[model samples]
Target: MVDGKGKKMSKSAGNVMAPKKIIDQQGAEILRLWVASENYREDIRVSNEILKRLTESYRKIRNTFRYLLGNLNDFDPVKPIGYR
Candidate 1:
């Protein structure tokens, strides 16, 4: 979690982020983004509010990819398009 004040996230600082809560609320990608976006030198704060928002977006994306892959598995590209 970030104080949004340039402080570092650490257990000693009482700003440690929870993984289960983050995944449960933010899905995963957003949490991933937060990890990628933030500098390791500084601490990040991850409140439930942010987690919930990002999770919904992540869920939509996850479902879309699943649907596409599942549907594409039944395709038959070998049938000559013009002949069949």
Candidate 2:
């Protein structure tokens, strides 16, 4: 594990990040998403910068879903709408 500054996370170094802390602050879903999104083929870096970017991406995804749902609210299921 690596800290936000790219330093190796270690108990001796007092830089280890507690899982509970991350889950508490960002939720379990965000933590899971971060792990799943990574390649995991090599050393993984966990930093505030990475988390910030991931949070921003998650927000964008939520906004996109909201926009799509809002636009579809006016559509009628009984009548198929023609797409351009």
Candidate 3:
């Protein structure tokens, strides 16, 4: 894995980022999204900026879903409304 600045992660280098800490601060969903978005064939880079971006993306998707669902508050499945 690589650091956000693209440097190799190392113990002695003091650049290791703990997963538990990230999970506690950002939630596991964000981490999962980050992994799924990366190309795995190369070194994975981690940084505050990347996590922040992912969080924003997650929020956008979640908010969009919430908005779409919110509009269906009065929806009736059995009595579907016909389009005008």
Best-matching candidate per lDDT: 3
Ranking by TM-score: 3, 2, 1
Clash count for candidate 3 is: 0
TM, every model? 0.51, 0.79, 0.86
lDDT of each: 0.68, 0.81, 0.93
Candidate 1 whole-model C-alpha lDDT, 0 to 1: 0.68
Model 1: ten consecutive residues of lowest lDDT: 42-51
lDDT of 2 at 52: 78
What would the per-residue lDDT of candidate 3 be over residues 16-45, giving only the tens digit for each residue? 879898999999999999989998898899
Per-model clash counts, in order, read 9, 0, 0
Residue-wise C-alpha lDDT for candidate 2, range 51-76, written one tens digit per residue:
77888888899899999999998888
Span of 10 residues, lowest total lDDT, candidate 3: 74-83
